[model samples]
Target: MVEAQAPLKHGGWITFPFFIATMAGLTLAAGGWNNNVIVYLIEEFNIKNIEAAQIANIINGCVNLFPVVAAIFADSFLGSFGVIVISSSLSLLGITLLTLTAMLDPLKPPSCETGSSFCQNPSKPQLFVLYTSLALASLGAAGTRFTLATMGADQFNNSTHQGIFFNWHFFTFYAATLVSVVGIIYVESNVSWGLGFGLCVLANLVGLVVFVLGKRYYRLLKPQGSPYTALARVVVAAFRKRKELQSSNSQDYYDETQKGQRNIVGTTPSNKFKFLNRAALVTEGDTNLDGTIKRPWNLCTLQQVEDLKALIKISPLWSTGILLCTPIAIQISLIVLQALAMDRHLGSHFQIPAGSMIVFVMITTSIALAIIDRFLIPMWQKLFGRSPTPLQRIGLGHILTVSSMAISALVESRRLDSARSHKLYGNSAVPMSALWLVPQLVLVGAAEAFHFPGQVSLYYQEFPKSLKSTAAAMVAVFIGIAFYLGTAVVDLFRKTTGWLPNGINDGRMDNVYWVLTVIGIVNFGYYLICACLYKYQNVEKAELNDTNSG
Candidate 1:
């Protein structure tokens, strides 16, 4: 299977540098604009602070949501290589438009004077250009991120190498993002937005060129049609044969998909979700004389039934991740608002960009990944006779997520107290240093280090082989959903309480963090229950430790 899929001459270590370079350029370009969009909307488009945060969250939701669609296209039609090429081109076009918006005075509203309550909004034409640019760039980014990971993983036949690739994949991802958050955001904040966006355009062009240059080295996979249709057929067949008697004999079940060669034979389905086994009962007239199914929707292969079962079983654990990520999303958006209202000076020379506060999260996550991949996993293997499992890592992430939110609540409380003491209100910067916000950001970063890659590795390892790209994309999909849900959460606070207002200093931002902390705690408890109940579907216990524990 390995040789047939990727001829030895085509894939392996030779493709690594190309893939890594492409990922670095693309991620840097994406982070350049995405990281500072809230500030752009506020400073250039004259949007309100809270409304800008909401818009940022919505944009994030779209960016993440597009990955799943991209994944589907990669798995069903374009393949990862083709998708990357097209998406990278689109990204280039989008960033060029964005640069123009930053350069042209007519494309933005007039800047508001300090301490003014009134600010003119961007004209309709300006907004149209802005949103169109954002949409194209976001769509392009969504296509590349996880689909690229899947493509990289496809280069290796060994599961261990694939796991290592995933580790480095994210490390590189966060590291590039760190650079953009610090460098590009500093330029946007301290210098000119036009210059900053121009740099992004250049990065996007380079990334696209580098990716296309590696075409020959890639071991591109052919699309396998839509895996969703196969899964759907399983459900339809199972429902059609719901009343059929159960078959205990292995041969009675249809495993014809594996009939051709080797030592494989018909296999009995597991006891769990056994009701679905009716789909593969091999009843009369189900198969023709040559053994093909006469009625496609009335019968399915055992493998198909098992694939659907795998998805169904793991769904509970998957859902816990949504709530787990929601708090982080909310915290991230609010952190920018907090930074804007606090003293951000580093010594006397410079003030940190409010948007760049997220750099701390990226830095810590990258450092954490390095430690986990090198020291921690290795040390655990020597002491405990096994490395930590993905579920264990994700469990730790859940705990840290809650801890981070608690710390955020505490920090926000102190900031609020300082604001009250100083009579800071309505865009007045508090005397407190923004450095106080670092602790919570660090914790959130550490939490992401554990869960984000863990979730990706888990899905890739467990999902059916035909859905590899989709498996890699599941994490992005949930994170996207979480961002949308985070927006709703913010709106809920706005509608129901005085927690979030246009001037955060004048409102109860601390209460918002406290509420989020409580939500995190409850969600963590639910995650514990789900994790405890879940079982590994594809890899054996020992194999999981060997391949994915890192």
Candidate 2:
């Protein structure tokens, strides 16, 4: 029985690398949009730092949240194909608006265009249009990101497949980020910023078309998901489950197919459940204990509640971890830099591209994640009894962040010195070697590679099976917090410390490193306390995870 079902369930062209590749492309596109747009928004909006970061935080958090919503829809009503198509199409529309914003004559800011001092205040109408466009893009991002990864993982069935799902899951994940590194560093930083955004929107369009082309042969998992019910159902299932099992010995086992799903009922947000059979990714539809009549909801079933609790708690660790997002927020803050005391000239090209530091940060950080996991951890495990946990990796990641900030402080202090010596020019000019940015960017990327994977893995594993999409959504939530906090801190700094004897404010692009570096130090300490409390799972527990997902 095992042999017969195994090959068919696990291996096929659906597990083909190409299918995974296409899915990975969507992930890259979503992340690329999240990443590249920040730099431009900050520049265009003349926004405060915290206000700027709110953009990234809001977009990423909502993107993460919508997945749970989409997952429910997919499992219950919309099939995977339907959701993927809609999400991808929405992304295309959102990106088009962004493209229009970018392609404006002389590429104007949200409030005012280049070479114009006409209006001091852009109305709510303009802001509303921009927000509307961004909001739609965010919606598309949230749904597509959730489904694409889940779908990619679904491509392999663990019971009979030779495809190493665990490996491929992370492999596709890392591969997608590799593309983000390119988008951040090369596309956004190296190319015309508008062109970078244009590509992001275009990628979504192409992805939708291609996904349609391949739809026929794909094995749409019979969506055996749970309904989008409220938390009360989880409680009822536990109570009834104990009653049914009370008559049996502790060793007694019940096949999931033997019982019907626990009955659930609800309205809008507040819902409830009655005694019903639990559900699974795929399950036997029989409702009676004797396996008589068969019926099941095509929604995510609560298969493993005990395991899910452990997973959901890990989200706060990542709550503030996507530090690369800060740079995204900074693009808008650049206008502040220009207003404060920066010199935009290259200082002979060796000067750092202060505005573009995040690009290098994301690239190197992703590379570091690959190196630490594949190479460094193996070597360390051989030498020591332990391989690094996600918490450990996060700690290591923060060290780089802290260091990046410290370096920024030193750089800013030096710039201040140069200005005092009359060697430094104005706020819109560059003073130091662009190479000075390498360490900060590289450190940021290293931090990312180390923290994000395990953090994401922890979130998915910790949340109850039915809530994978929702818990994964939490990873983006902290980033939102981080974004808001970062922006707020910057605003405060600019208003308070923005001024120096030379008329420089802390918002100067060069001086902003000082801000990031210091904030990184503080963020690192907080991450330390959080990491200590974090509980994680081992590789052995993954299979049983299926047994308990409800």
Candidate 3:
């Protein structure tokens, strides 16, 4: 069976690049809205730092669950095709609604008298319309991301194609980021805010259309495994196996069904109760009364569940890691918005847009991931004899995160000094170019290259077939929890300090960066600990003897 499947599932080599392109498109089309939320909220609602961050937190946290929910519906009742179609259609409505809201009620005016746009706030109607629109956009992002990645994976046929898709996932991520970077930095910053969001909205609609157009090339998979169910089966099987090994009871071995009251058909219990009878089952023995051979019980055994249970449990580690690692993306929103608001040179001439650094990371990293997987992986494998596993890649990524955070801490510490120095001169805080954040941003992109690949592969690899979607959902859940936890941390700090002078008590953006830097370092340590303690799934070889594995 393994031999047969191996020959059939070989994917294409060149198709990898296009796969990455598709992945980039899918990723950017999915989550790009996250970066702009802080600025969007502040501008639209005239909210303070904590309030805006809270909203951003909510959006990120909620977006993940939608996919899990959709995946559930797809697996159980609606087929994958039906689920995708409904989601895509809803996606168009959500994106268009955001565009309409932004255009109809602009979040910011073109010009301000003092040239400090934060000085003037929007009216209530303007605020309400913008937020409502953003909420719609978030809705679109959730459903859109759910189908997009899985759909992109559809382009590859395991049997007919080569290994092109192995790398294509990364490529697709960059392609989407290309649009996001351009939209946020150039389109949104240079044109109107509405245009930036509208750009993604349009891009998403295109993505939806592309999916609909290519439905034929894609293979629809049947969702038979539920990870939660698989895990339960494993636990039960393990205990039963243990009991048999201990010779606890001859009848207790596989006769668990017989332990309960099971009436035969036409008995006192009623005909319906016959369905529950295990005593009348085709009992296995050396030979039956009809001289038939002995047989093993099916489905309700311990060994059957092991393959899936391992994946379900191991997935949480990667998921937890992603949750902790990715929400730093919020820095693009919360930190950048605060930086721009307080930067002395934030006027038109010296202005550095909030989303530009995130754009920089997206553009640069997308290119790098293409190079890393295609060009770098092979070279390293040849040189090292054995290449790094996904787990190894993730471990290395934490090192990069530590460095990025350290850089942020240093830049922020200096910004504080600069502010104080300018205060002495009776100026607005001393202005620094947003360029200071470049190192951190660049490192983040590199870290992502290391982190996302290993983590996602580990996820798909570990779980049983029935638990695939559940494994996917568990990953999403971990990330969601991490984002929510990060939000809570920020909110707690704000409530404690913001009421005091300068909110954080340091009186400026520099202080916030200082705190984030310290927290990032702590998170780095925590992640390392988690990684060290984590037990990985042992790879199982295909066994034709077992009907299930076969």
Backbone clashes for every candidate come to 0, 60, 31
- Which prediction has more favorable TM-score, 1 or 3? 1
Q: Which stretches of candidate 1 lie over 4 Å from their true place?
A: 1-8, 12-14, 155-168, 243-252, 257-265, 378-383, 539-550
Write the candidate numbers in order of decreasing TM-score: 1, 3, 2
lDDT of the candidates, in the order given: 0.85, 0.54, 0.54
Candidate 1 per-residue lDDT over residues 1-550, each given as its tens digit: 1223455678788888888888898998999999999888888888889999998898899888888888778777888888998898888888889999989889888888633678887789999999899888888888897788888989888999988887788778878898899999899989999999988888888888887888788887887767887888988999999999998998888886655321136889989899899998888888777777787799888878988988988898889889999989998899998998899999999999999999888789878988999999999899877777888889889889989988888988898889999888876788999999999999998999899878988897878886665876788889999999999999999999988888888898888888888888898888778777666767666556343322
**Candidate 2 residue lDDT tens string, 1-550:** 0012123444354645545655666666665666545455645654433444456656655765567677777776666667888887787788777766667733344455422335243356556666777888888876766576566556555535523554565567666765664543356655665676677766666667777776655656656545335244434444434444222221122223324443333111111222232322223342455532233322223343333334345545555565535643443333233322444345455323334444565567557767886899899789755566555665766676567566655756665565656654433344444454456556656767776665666665556554655555566555555556555655665578643212342235456666566666676676776666554454464433332211
**lDDT by residue for model 3 over 265-284, one digit each (tens)?**
21221122222222223233
Q: On a 0 to 100 scale, what is the lDDT of residue 490 in model 1?
A: 95
Error of 2 at 125 (Å): 3.9
Model 2 quality (TM-score)? 0.68
Off by over 4 Å in 2: 1-11, 14-57, 104-124, 158-198, 226-232, 235-356, 419-426, 457-474, 485-550
C-alpha TM-score for every candidate: 0.91, 0.68, 0.71
| Most accurate candidate by TM-score | 1
Better model by TM-score, 1 or 2?
Answer: 1
